[model samples]
Target chain A: MTKESKKDGGVNPRDEAKERLENFALKVLESVNQIEPPKISIPSRSTSNIVFDEKERYYTISGKTVTRTSANMRQVKKFAQTMCAADFCKDLIESKKTATLREMYYISEGWETGGFADQGRSDRIVEDLESTFGVKREDLGLLPEEDGASIFGDIVIDEGGMEVKATKVGRAGYTIPPTMSDVEFVECGADCVLAVETMGMYHRLIQEEAWKKFDALVVALKGQPARATRRFLKRANKELDLPVYLFTDGDPFGFHIAMVVISGSAQLAYINHELAVPEAQFIGVTASDIENYDLPTDKLRESDVQRLKQLLKDPRYSDDIWQSEIKKMLNLNKKAEQQAFSKYGLEYVVDKYLPEKLT
Target chain B: MTKESKKDGGVNPRDEAKERLENFALKVLESVNQIEPPKISIPSRSTSNIVFDEKERYYTISGKTVTRTSANMRQVKKFAQTMCAADFCKDLIESKKTATLREMYYISEGWETGGFADQGRSDRIVEDLESTFGVKREDLGLLPEEDGASIFGDIVIDEGGMEVKATKVGRAGYTIPPTMSDVEFVECGADCVLAVETMGMYHRLIQEEAWKKFDALVVALKGQPARATRRFLKRANKELDLPVYLFTDGDPFGFHIAMVVISGSAQLAYINHELAVPEAQFIGVTASDIENYDLPTDKLRESDVQRLKQLLKDPRYSDDIWQSEIKKMLNLNKKAEQQAFSKYGLEYVVDKYLPEKLT
Candidate 1:
């Protein structure tokens, strides 16, 4: 709503969402006043367009659809329930409260059915609302579902007209916000954004104050960044023109989580254009890192091997770099998780590993 | 290079593909003569359009593109190789011979370096040729890689100007071909089309002459019907307008095969308009049937249970009928394959089971 009011620092995503919700409601009311059932249209995740952009080197949504209204009763009920969720989210943002999606889904559990059978069904409707508005639920002031990830560096944001120097406060940098857009990205002086897959390695860098030393924004992705985190990083890249680098475990799943941030997951493939960080390049915790750093003994699990075989056949992992890395893992019969870096001692991440891998 | 010449019964799908290939080659030659590298454009299988038709009650493709000459000489080479594949297919059909997709992929193994690294890659490019041309590879005279199912029934086809009644010639029935379009549906006097998911159940019926007894066309899908079989079924339904009943094991994979006939697979989501048969209904070997017939105790496998759990969460299996079936399997801690009906004796399928389930 109203083009994300640009303030002293940066645009506030929460305020923008709240304003859009108001405009959407007003439109619905106008339609109802004329006795027409408001057609609440959201991009259907079920009917998604997943395309690989060769130039940009990421998969993106090139096609999508609004929710169907052919089934009259279902359409009306879906629209009404989405509106209810939207209103609840607005209240959360305004009151400076945050909710996990589970909390929001069951917010009106006993009193009303909301016609949802389980948390899965409820979450889909919520996603419909998010995709419909093209605003993440977290940016609407919903905290992340998982208790993971943190941020550190010279980034300032406008929170309620007050400029917040994120890295200056607290002993270990800033605990990431629910919806990052609630705070404006006022300034990013960091030369680059370094996204890490695990919290252990992330905190090691924060404790070392690596962000300040290396002029980087150190973000622990906590294995697949929540929508808000991805959105924030995407915006930071666009607004600040910062090069982004990623580090994950030398395993299929860890690499998959990294891909989720870089190219977007197939489950939410439609939202990639807005959330994916295309400029991000794989830094390390690579298969080769196991030998180069001489970390620890490793053996790939059955499931790991299964996933590796799939990645071998996957179209997205068709690039030469990905092919070689996967082939290396298959041949070596090993996988290294992020925590394996701990074997090298704490300072190894900040001193030896980070600097060595960055180049 | 003209349209398929409609003969006595129906248009030959193979002849049509051959004509299309000729027309396509001429277009490329014309362009090459004008000094432009010939770009053979096929609807990219990688890029597909899936639309749910309000009127048709199944998904359909509404869009596509020919991944064409935007690239350099490499793209031209790729296009030429794919054209070469199409040419080989055309030759196979004209010679009244057939080859599996695996055979076709390896046809030029020792000769040209089309840059294909594996059968999987070769298969995808060949599939793209199918999707691009809106024709099945089987219709291009290629057979399935696996031998799983069979059918001997009332179906008749126009194979190279000769009419062949599949059920009449043999002691049991006619063996289904790779490309059903190679044979036109001459006469489907059967009251209904009964598609069986497994070979055991199909042969049981054929051996017992169940199709004759019940006035039905019995087909053993052999765990997912080839495109030729699916096309034959689809055409029979449209032209003959026969009610179709699918009988499979009361398990997730069986149901999946049934769905492949009814709605088409996600792998083939793009070509649904030509392939999917919407009116088909699951007739028997249902979860409830086990109880009704008092079939033997067969505990569900871990894999079966896993697939059932996935089916429980699938959007396609969202209907109440599907929900209860999956729930019943979970509740009973048991599953039944189509062969399980043999416990009641082979005649049970033709006599007691078919009559009871059909109603």
Candidate 2:
């Protein structure tokens, strides 16, 4: 859903979009116009190429390789395809039109003719371009659409002449853009952010005026947070320097979603720094919280047991909080979704759970 | 395996192949020359468009609608591509070359430009052309080479000056072409055809001189009978009027293979008359044969159990023999492979099992 822009006075992005495209093209032309063989540098997304920095509390791509003409002809196809996609993506941004990953694939197919076998090759090339530029595809105005997140907060943002007040939208809320670098956050009043896993729980809190009462912004992740939701939450945590907390189902998927938000997803491992909210904490529906709140038991699904068993083996969940909480869940053989808190009464979540957890 | 010529006197097929190619191209040119909208008829392989005839004992394409330039523009593209493929196959035949289904798909993709989505669409169109022409792709000289079935019989045929006598090839046998319309079987001395499911049993019987002793022709199916095996067996049954017996393990896959040979596979359902051996008898290693032969029991694998359970529910397995045999297998939770017959003695299958079962 589109929201009214909060900053009608913000700078127009059309000129900025053109400038970004021109700069990307200039880099390519500069390399091509070189006296020596062109060497393009790119960060490797392969796990072997990523390093965990405990001091910085985040992971970063370590292997920065410069592509040059060598005896190994293996990189020839990849290098040509990456350069082709980069040139194409710049054209997309300059034309002021967004292309889905699928559209970009078809465009590549048309450009390369018989060179491309299928969409998979094109998708990899797009990723190579993203890693090379140190930016997300959405930042280049390419989008898949319909999977961005919903946010209701005391924040103001403008797109073109449209002014959107996130807090005033009430229960409906505003959709976070797939790429928020273009969106200007004119004002920020929320003290913290509560990222809820389910829309049902988010609405209940909204109906109760939980955000206004607790002075926190509420985000409904819908299930596992989409790439846009994670990006938005990461930015909110960093820019406002506000504490971010996650509330999800007391199930394995929920635990993994929370982990993915805090520590980046492996699929998008290359751009982890642009998305992860490392300092974020999960607030509810943790395993122990079920007994403390006397939430009614829902029978554990077969999938829940399987996922819980898996989480126990994962190295990342070796932390004391994750291990103990997961162990408790396994022993209970029951998972409580966030909506289960409604068993304590609709207002109980905002009145009791929030006060107890937050304080 | 190459065999000596049983007959040096046979028709040369280069002229025949050339004639077929000229006729195909002329038909396309005639369509182009037509003053009005030209029409093309194809036997649609869609299950919904198929009609099962119990009386005639075969399935036929129901719709007789010729593809023209009216509303259903769907057939126009398919018709053009199919004609294009037929033209390409003729080119392969005339050029004395062969192409696999994958090669054929790439040829279609190159020829039609944007007509195909994948190999699957191209394959279906090829099948349509095959059904329409009443010929196999290999018969049109588009050979995949390795998937063809091998047969050992007192028969001979000549192709492009190469003469092959099935009996002279000895134990190695002659690989049957996908289609036998051009092949000439010069001799048939055997009383019947023994279609053994495994090469082990076929070899054992051949070594024992069982074919000459019992006045029978032996065919080792290797595993599930390929299209070539099914077609050759069907033609032998129809033309030579030879009694055909199928010998397979008392298991689910074995049963399915027997059924495919008896009532053609759904994949080739359009060409049932050219492949199915409905009158063929199932011989040996049945559920009841365990006690008669004192075969040792082997526990059924999980996949075997699943397949057995599925076979019981199939509408076609409603026959009394199939029901009783499968029911017994499910109840026992055991299966006996055909090799189990060797438990009595090395030649027990030929000496005892065959004598008892055939009698």
Candidate 3:
């Protein structure tokens, strides 16, 4: 929808989330006191409700809603969980803290009757809360536990209050945090952001100082871009005026990861406006690269072939570039990793392939 | 077993590795040219060859050897692969570059008959080379593709020639590189290092600035410690004289990971001296923690119980503390995660649990 704000004409996302949760809890409390049904309405997050917002260049939810009420036994446990989770988020914001999704699941164990039996059930509630409140889970001080991705090169960021230069960090670069809300881009000397899908390729690029050659900041997505990684790239792409290029393997899964980073995943469509980098480009290890670079490749597995066929119908991959690439990959019956470029030599990807693709 | 060195009264691990490879290659060439069978003798790395080196406080190989020769059809491929891998490594060293194990495996795809059918075959060759040459794969310019692990707190490391202050970095801290040989400990402000098993707990500690509270450098192990993470911990412990305490989930798998950091795993027994930190201690989320903190727990799965049974017989976990802990967990039939402490509050792990355990 729109950026969160406060009554005093200032933007405070955390405060906004806290206030939303408080207001929601108040409504339920008042309903209970009046001997009326306590219920929460959340947007339907089913696949049928997902739509490719061509104007926004990302997946988003349609205007369909589902209501959960304490009145129905089948929906009561979920209803109670939703209320309890809202309370938990409020407590986190009040304490100026956050909880990982996994931690939140475990923390629920202490709740009298609102505890979650599994993480998947707890995760769905967080998603429901996000859509119900029109805010990100990140805004609600609920973070998903993410893999350690990394960023390197000529960029400065204000973490909490301290300014840190990515260039001045460790050899492996700066660790991409679980949340990027507290991080503000202070400065950038890069022309673009190169997001590599594999850590091996990313490390090779860093070791070869490819960032300097391209005058770009490099980030390792570490497979499918983690939410924090996508947000980091989005901010870097937007705030720093840097174009984003996603470099991944020559497979359906890799192409899908690039699509997720560029246009947002259907599953997480609710946060597309905040997380998606619609301008992001997918640069190589595409099916064409296998032929052009004569890269080493593995025969596509049965699952890979199936994924490619499915992606052919996915709206996110409808663009000519993606469609052509996916079709070519299926035809070739081959998949190559980012590391497959090393068949040319260890420096080939950094010294040759990347320069060719980016330039 | 002594430090790698150049003949010119200087220590240069890379150069030393290069020389060893060159010499080995020369011997092989001589054998082939003279029409003799080209053979390489490698230290046996099987379980029977592993021993608990009590003085070293780690697992190491015993005085046993195995031979691979081009004389046999089965060994011929391995023999050729070894020769080609050495040549590949020499090229990397000469070019002042490195290949990730995955890349090396892929690179071999161009080596005609020397190409590996799978990554497993290639990985074993690298390990064989390591034990054969008495040098780490890192020294040979063969790097393992590792998960991104972070290091935070008051410590300075010389990455290549540039110095990095981990505390002055981003919110997630310094990203620990795949190889730590090039990283020199420059300075330290912390008294000890806290190696965390999970990123979620690590993030919680960072959010709360637990390092400041305990005067410790906090490192996220990101599950069963990657080789790079273990090396980073070892170097930090040994070079900075910082005591290391591993904080992990109170489960059989978690305990085993902690043990791997303290006493090297049997599989990589060859690199124990370089990678293992014998003095490292498990700081809890122990079986004791389940009772001590009234932490939330899950019933030990059949798998967890089996793993505990295995660890009970593992030499690394033979001590009274481990034996007692493993038995207690079995008796309780329960396991807990580092995040289980979040049942109290998001900051419980950092503000309370760690401070209590670390102190």
Q: Give the top-scoring candidate (lDDT).
A: 3
User: What are the DockQ scores of the candidates, in order?
Assistant: 0.01, 0.01, 0.67
Give the per-residue lDDT of model 3 (tens digit) for A128-163: 999989877877888877774688888777766788
Candidate 1: which stretches are off by over 4 Å?
A1-359, B1-10, B33-37, B40-44, B47-59, B62-66, B70-74, B93-97, B110-115, B342-346
Candidate 2 chain B least-lDDT 10 residues: B1-10
Against the correct fold, how does model 1 do in TM-score?
0.46
> Which lDDT tens digits does candidate 3 get at residues B67-182?
99999998998898899888888888898787788988888878966578889989999898888888778878888777756888887777677888888877777877776657
Q: Residue A326 error for model 2, in Å?
A: 1.4
Checking candidate 3 for backbone clashes, the offending pairs are: none
Give each candidate's fraction of reference contacts reproduced: 0.00, 0.00, 0.88
**Residue A149, candidate 2: alpha-carbon lDDT:** 61
Stronger candidate by TM-score (1 vs 3): 3
- Expressed as tens digits, the lDDT of each residue in B163-238 for candidate 1 is 6555543322344444455455555557788888754455457657788888888876767677757876787677
Poorest 10 consecutive residues by lDDT, candidate 3 chain B = B1-10
Task: Itemize residue pairs with steric clashes in candidate 1.
Answer: A9-A186, A13-A181, B43-B132, B149-B222, B158-B184
